[model samples]
Target: MARHHTVRALLVGGPMYDSLYDRLPAFERATGLHVDVVDRLPHPELNARVKREFESGAADFDLISTHTKYAPSQATWLSPLDAELGAEIDDFLPQPRELSRIDGALLQVPRYLDVRLLYYRRDLLGGSSVTVPRTWDALIEAATTLTRPGIYGFLFPGRDSGLFGTFYELLVSAGGHLFDANLRPAFDDAAGVWAADRLAELHDRRGLTPRELPAWHYDEVSASFRRGEAAMVCDWPGSHHLYKARATCDVADRVGLALLPSGPAGIRAAYSGCHSFAIPRTARNRAGAVELLRDLTSTAAQLGEARRGAIPVRASALAQIRAEAAADPAEAHRWELLTRTQEAMIIPPRFAAYPECEDAIWHAVQRAMTGVVSPQAAVREGAQHIVALLARERLSPQPNTV
Candidate 1:
């Protein structure tokens, strides 16, 4: 017999989590455990809030909507779920399946995955006879040839976190990492310089992005791409529906999806992350929280989310998404996007102090992008700051999931 509990959940709100929020009532009814959800914030903000709320006092949340990378850092805040998750490992796709554990403790049950994809305007590019780019240099060439008075070639966020993610993607694709085995900053070398220089040339030299690239948010980038102001964008998969829906997008009909182009490293590093549900160690309703996690990740729930534009965490849901091709070719194509992106997936490093290191690098990226410092100088300075940070704290690199 299974124990039931009334659980309080803190969920990250946004389109990515909409289906889960919408389906909570049914989940409560099915399990007879009331789930009281706190307000949802944007992804990064929600994680920040969770950390704040958890640290302010005793655990206020029994269950939470979190990311796979976060579980490693906050392992103490989360209860081990290995005994609860027996034999369920085979249900998930590779990324989530491998990331669910922290120090060998099953701490999170993944809900959905996020990966970078190449979103482009098929109409414009096809007219130029430009096929999808398979490499970064090719992408740059296409962007250069495609840029004009108003229509830019590439659109990506330029704010701090966005900009950092940008450099991180390039660094990974160029065979570099934020930190090496000894927990020292490793992104200041050749790859970092080239990445910064390329970005500088695109925005300042050739004008491939918005004039106010530094001020742009992710939403603005998506909007520009959706409005056909940009020929292509390297971004997350959420834009697939937005670009395909004629009612919301001007270029919906001409949109084309492709894998993120390979970088100088000769591999397509799939920049990725996932949203997951986790129970707190101090939860008052442990049993109910576990059940809620199970139900939210169920096939029906995942399918509902998939239809609403989220990648399912489970293998069965992925199969169900593939089945959509029989009824609607467009929907099927979307599923195929998920499949292709999964193959090139690259997860960020996980550790309690990873955010601090990320912020330091972000500041450096900003300085380089804004011409406050050359890319080479920015990364060199950033690496120095990181060494100091490492000295102040005992940080260690965790093993990669892949």
Candidate 2:
């Protein structure tokens, strides 16, 4: 029989945590372990606080819920779960598993997956003779097709980081590279210029939305699209569930999800992100924390999470999802979209300075979106900032072997 443990965790307070809280009681009852969840700050602020805690030698967190991409850099501050939970690591979905590893030792185990999809209005596309886009050019044209007096063609979050993250998939898909193998900035080349120009043109030429929409984050972008003010928008899967609920949006039935178009690289990349469970080195009960992680990642817990609208991180949970979809059509559609986009999802390079890079890139993109700077200038500045950050922090390209 597996050993039981009483664990403490500091979880980010948000919709995601609510889902975990709903499932925790059962896991606790089964394992004879108690879970104490503390809601800290928002995503960005929580990350900052974690850093401050580590720097000040006041690390009080046991298990920290965080993104997978930063696991490698954070490995020093995190304990290895691989030795304690090898079998559990093997059960994770490929993408989530890859994201969890840092120098062959898993620093984080994904609790959920975040994948992007194109959200569109079924009424507009079905009623009109306009065909949905299958390519970049076609996407722009379709945006025009859906644009009317009040309704805009596209509804993406235009803020620096929000829009930039989504746009990277397009840039990479379009044969534009952000960072080279040496971990150097490479977004100043010909392909980079073309990609940025096209993104900016969506606002300047094609009628997208709000004019100030670039300043909007996920919530505002999703709210605008769900309320039927925008025709097509690219967003995380969470939007799909929100729009489909009866109490959520009026256009739930009229909403349709599509696979984003493939770019010049012939690779259809979807901007993907994941949230994982990690144990900080400062945990008072490291052994107990790993046990809790093991239970949270079990097949049953993952399936429960999937049913609650988050993507399952375990491969076995997919079967559970398939069975549940057999009973619900809406869930079936959502699952179909996720399965199709699964391979196309892209994980950002895992680096200790990734958060800094992400924040810088987000700021640059926001500046461009708000017209404070040109897209070309924004990319150039972003590249410079990224390179300078690497130098300032002395980040290495590969995992430390010594």
Candidate 3:
């Protein structure tokens, strides 16, 4: 086989993940192998594109960005990494390592562990009598009290998987499971209704969020907070650097980090997963892909990303970041909150149809929030759609093994 010198890739591109791409020239210089980014889109778009490419049997890229939750859908076409990348896997945190595996096959190398934490404006909280909210109900109360003409009390991504993830975290925290042991839909119960109603209340009844919220995605929500438009937001670790950078954030000096508030069930839940890289079964440059994967997930690479506020999946990189953070009070406080909240992280059940399931639920939740449908109707209809989806998926042909 002729060896290809240029490795083609499709990657997740945005403020949060793009900084790592800056180091690609260095990889090229050292390895004498070029990294050609064939496509660079935000995660949701990237997921949709990858699905389209794979389904049409046109996944021509050598390597691509993937997520633990979405990996199962692409597992059949993903080349297992365990044989090609050996001891390097040993350096990853157990959760990330396990999340990257499917039926015991290592399918991806994790770039970061993503979990949402509460980001608030300390100045706003300090100026008001409202203390930091510790529960969902209390958060509602605080948000209502803090809301005014210029600023909304809370902000969140209102579309796509970001919206679904917000609802999933709240549903779990309210003691609702997404599915029963048999994999049937189980989110139409009272707890699920409660979760949906809370979002509706924020957007519809009380107007605690922007009127245009239903159209906003992750970047928009985070950007709103940076512009000093929201008092509080739940955001991933990747956005932490932007929140703290005075040059980009209007409220940078007033930023504060904390664990997400608990729900009625007394559980603090965060929808979480690992962002990773994987080689395609159709890769034209398999050797080059492996080398690039190693270079991208190396300790130094992870450390650089960690410094920019991404949570490193490599154990050594995490420890080094922690040690460095200990000297800075603000960074230390941020790490402390993240450490204490690990137990509260909620990873979704992996399945090939998971993205479709998210689509159904988020659209339902959005309809409810926008007052196009009642909360009860939304959950009930969403559950019904998922029941049919799962049934159809079960009857469909299983993916081919790599």
Candidate 4:
């Protein structure tokens, strides 16, 4: 095969990930192989575009940014990396490494681990009697009491995968499962209703969130909290650096971190996964793509991102961060809370049609939160739609790989 000097890639772009791309120049300078970023959109848009390209047989990019939850759907078009990257894979943290594979084949390089934590304004909570809210009811009470003229009580992503993920964690925390023994939809039960009701109460019944929340995604929710417009938010680790940056955040010094509050069943579940990079089977510059993948996921690269608040997947990078955290009280508390919360992390079921299922659920959830329907009715409708979708796609529940 002729060696190609340029590699094209489709990447997920945002404030949280833009810093990593800033280092691409170093890679290009060292290897003399240019990287062309074909497209850079958020996760949902990137997923849709990649699906369209793959289905139309027009996937010309050599590499793409992907997440563990969406990898199963794209596995057919991704090239297996076991033989070429096995040694590098061995150094990754075990859970992230497991999430980077599909059906026992290493298909991607793990970049960072993502899990949601409750981020609040320490100034707001400290003066109040609310003591870090250990349960959902307690959180609601705190949020209600904290609501003021300019500040809303709570904030969360209201659409797309973010909304679906929020609902998933709440459902699991309530002692519910997404699927039962036969892989059927099991979220329409009482637990599901309870989860949906909480979201409804926050948005519609009590008006604790912004009026435009139904259209907001992860970025919007994070921005709202950074502006000090909300007292609390459930957000991912990727936003940690921004939350602490005095330049971008109004309440930077007042920020506080805590594990997610427990549900009625006493479970504190967090939606979690790893963001990664993969080579497509149709990649024109396979060698360059592989080399770029290795460079992007190297310990040095991961350490840079980790210092900026992302959870590194490489064991060495993680160790370095832990040592650094030991000396900083704030960093030490954040790291300890995140590590303990990992025990309650939950990932979506592995299946090719999972994205479609997520859409069905989030739409129903949006309807509930907007008062188009009751929580019970929304859960029932969402479950029915998922069952129909699974049948249409002829998909069976695949066992979890991690």
Against the true structure, whose TM-score is highest?
4
- TM-score on alpha carbons, each prediction: 0.88, 0.87, 0.96, 0.97
Ranking by lDDT: 4, 3, 1, 2
- Clash totals for all models, in order? 1, 4, 0, 0
* Better TM-score candidate (2, 4): 4
The positional error of residue 6 in candidate 3, measured at the CA in angstroms, is: 0.8
Ranked by TM-score from best down, the candidates are 4, 3, 1, 2
1-402 in candidate 2: lDDT tens per residue? 222355767776654445556767876787677777755554666677778778889777668878776556567898877788766567776657766777667788887788878888888874548666777767777787778877888877776456777668777887877788888988777666656666766776564667877667677777888778888887775445577775767688888878887777677888777777899877887877877777766788777767766787787897778887978887787778788997787667777888788787777766665556787897888889998889877664433212
Give the Å shift of residue 47 in candidate 1: 2.3
Highest lDDT among the candidates is held by which one? 4
Encode model 1's per-residue lDDT on 224-251: one tens digit a residue: 8887799998766554566667776888
Q: Write the per-residue lDDT of candidate 3 for residues 280-372, one digit (tens) a residue.
A: 999999999999999889999999999988899999999999999999998898888888777788887787888888899999989988888
Those runs of model 2 whose alpha carbons end farther than 4 Å from true positions after fitting are: 1-7, 27-34, 148-150, 204-207, 264-266, 326-334, 397-402
| Superposed model 1: Cα runs more than 4 Å off | 1-6, 32-34, 129-131, 148-150, 215-217, 326-338
User: What lDDT score belongs to each candidate, Candidate 1 first?
Assistant: 0.77, 0.73, 0.88, 0.89
Better of 1 and 4 by lDDT: 4
Could you give candidate 4's per-residue lDDT for residues 1-402 as a string of tens digits?
133888998999987888899888989899999999998999999999999999998778999999888998999999999998858688998888887878778888899998888999898885648678888888888999988889999998999998898889889989999888766899999999999999998899999999999889998999999998999999877778899887889899899998899998999999988999999999999999999999889999999999988899999999999999899999999999899888888888877899888999999988998899999999999999999888877564444544
Higher-lDDT candidate of 1 and 3: 3
Q: Candidate 1's error at 351, in angstroms?
A: 1.8
Clashing pairs in 3: none
Clashing pairs in 1: 270-346
